[model samples]
Target: MIFSRKIPLYEFFPKEFVDIHSHLLPGIDDGAKSMEESLDLIQGLIQMGFTRLITTPHIYGSVWPNTPEIIRSKAILLQEEIQSRKLPVSLSFAAEYMLDEKFMQYLDTSSLLTIKNKYVLIEFPNFQAPLQLHEILFRLNSMGYEPILAHPERYTYFENVINNIEELKEIGCLFQLNLLSLAKHYGTNVYETAIKLLKAGVIDFVGTDVHRKYHLDTLKKITSKKHLKLLETPFKNNFNLW
Candidate 1:
């Protein structure tokens, strides 16, 4: 099939962009290490034409183990820093939750950070999806939260199981493809998968998932017209629908 659907994309990045996923928070998870580095990364994203950012640090129970209070405190500090520097960007914080057994505690308490409205960003294990993945998503839905599966293309286990991805949406899960995946930053398989999802129009949103300047560098180098065209739909939907 010839891909004829198009969203208005600019010569560079679209101005209507609101990067819903990133790891710009310093000393948090595997993202930026220090406050200075965080500011620098945010600045680079701003230069790329992103007007707003919802930086999502990992909230794995065993690893990052971040709490909502801790995330909010850091966000307040970062917002002050941005103001001090007058970055002219809207900054917010949310957690990229690992959807696992440990996550039940949060669900039990109904304590979770939202990206917008009832939407929450979640990441599944790359090795294999949980046996009860659908049930978990159902639980989230029952709690009045919608899950946006972060970087679905990077999940190698389901590379050949395209219908499994469709099943995710059947219950409740929107797919968020990483922008770097299109640049082959994750690998060729991820790039191919991202393209497949884009062509299928299965990807609902896109993000830099910018862990470092290297990510920004790769994104900046995505100057090919074909590549940029593939990005237009996600960008437009993220800005308008979200």
Candidate 2:
């Protein structure tokens, strides 16, 4: 199906829309607290017309301690539930890995999860970026893993240092913006940065980054033509992931 740019935000989603990042996996991170909440959130996304979701649970260190095996197991359980209900949705799983020592260990030793074959979804600390952020990205590129940096606009450090963001783009890092950031859900700074990134045509993709119902609720309010116009440039490759 073809999507026209004139669609309103609330009705923006259609069956072809594939959300590449979300935290609907139950009990895995700071996302949905239980299976019930997870299913509810999935249902809400379906209601909003999202038929395909790559629900990414946090794989932070011992805080969440989610390994690939654990994520696969949990993902299977959720898929089964969705099937039992006969919901018209396609659920898949990857992970939003935090850039830290633990992530490096995974990168060095184990098979890290991917949004697709070689595309990994990653996030930086909200407070600051890792000291060896460039080195880490270089290593990923060398190893043939395409790192999709999630929600680049939400990071406080990048808010004032636009050069850092540009350098990332120059070095082959793909940027994913949180949809809520466009609605000022994070803050004015994030909203402005998201707009700037989109307007600059630096953002490669967009996702819900939804941790709870509040996020989904806020996403529904993104009705401005300006915002929708900006979003038109992104998520263009989301369907290709399938």
Candidate 3:
């Protein structure tokens, strides 16, 4: 079933890919354990047609508490090493700002690191949407950052309320769909919700969200040509596609 498509990997990836979500930076959170592992993962990603990887390490306000300075320093070190090793892929850093009280304070001080300092990726709690979401988005906007809600399809509260994501878009937040979700890697419910969001034209960006080898191994078996076709649609022409 995986190779039913005639083109194989050739036309599937007509160009080198741009993956907006990854945890490839070594020893930050639960991603790659060491620099050697990270380099290996980068090489694997390159062979998968990935040209750019925006590595977003988890920045749990109370738990991880990663500052912009630390994130940038790590990113710089890895970027230089990748270049020195002559790897053909690019690496950049952003924080996966888990929503919390301290995150709000970081927004107030404009200290939250983002992709290009324009697009900020945020994650919610697993089971429910916080009541303070609107206020958080308002504060993020006031600080001149566009909040990109990561993996909205995985949220159970929005499982039947897909329009809520659109409401967030109205409030200046974009939705980034996890590519694995489309493959049903999470579950049937999340997969169905992901397709619902995709068809409704609410998804603005798609990301690999690669955290480990198991994630990449799972991706190798995804034969959803429709998912790839949906990704190539006109609705995917968001500004970040570049």
Candidate 4:
């Protein structure tokens, strides 16, 4: 026997939800390719009832190499366009830093950009755990930045050692789940892990991590009741800090 049910994502995804993760900056990374596309994505988010957006473009050293100046400059240009068009949404910029050697150098010599001057969104390699993961989180905390580990459910390294997530939380690391993962956009394993984390109450925040229109479309197709209920938690989404 086989059975299935579907629920519209919009039914559970609050229109007022504050989105703190996205890549709508044009020509910066692997997200929007041009100004027009960026505007289109922003407008789409507005139509979806999102009141605020903190678009975080990737700051991978070898691939993206985006500095705070570069990101803010592009954001300023985008902001001007949004104003001229009178879009009814608030937008801001932060960077998703890859925990790599280059980032360590930045930690030593430069000030890292953060979300709302408090939270820092960070990521690791999908397939392997970094050698100095604990040290990095400790340093981030010592520097007064709340480190939010982006998409912990997507990391295969944690598949066999899921308990490590609790260890991370004990040490002040917050987990930001990718909204698409709940919708099964990545795969069954990711979707299952997302649900597990949600059930465990380890998910602190959720984000679109949207790179294009299709990502938004996939989110709209999500029909999981459990995923909707998980959103009810006090996810620092609308926190005044952002």
lDDT of each: 0.83, 0.86, 0.77, 0.85
TM-score of 4: 0.93
lDDT of 3 by residue, 114-195 (tens): 7765888899988777669999999788879888888988888774556687688889998888877866799999888888
lDDT-sorted candidate list, best first: 2, 4, 1, 3
Q: Could you give candidate 2's per-residue lDDT for residues 114-184 as a string of tens digits?
A: 88788899998878898899999999999999999999988887745467778997887988889889778
Model 4: lDDT of residue 229: 74
Output the number of the lDDT-best candidate: 2
> What does candidate 1's lDDT look like per residue over 23-76, in tens digits?
888897899999999999988888778878988899997889888888898889
Q: What is the alpha-carbon lDDT for the whole of candidate 2? A: 0.86
Q: What ranking emerges by TM-score with the best candidate at the front? A: 2, 4, 1, 3
Model 1: pairs clashing at backbone N, Cα or C within 3 Å: none
TM-score of 3: 0.90
Q: Which regions of candidate 1 are displaced past 4 Å? A: 1-11
lDDT, candidate 4, equals: 0.85
Q: Model 1 compared with the native: what TM-score?
A: 0.92
Off by over 4 Å in 3: 1-11, 14-16, 233-242
Tell me which residue pairs clash in candidate 2.
Answer: none
RMSD of each: 4.4, 3.9, 2.6, 2.7
lDDT of 4 by residue, 1-242 (tens): 87766767655556567787899999999999999999999988887667788999999988999999999999999999999999998888899999988988989988888888889999997668778999999999999999998999889778553598999999999888888897789899999988888888888888889999999898787775666677667244544436
Compared with the true structure, the alpha-carbon lDDT of candidate 3 equals 0.77
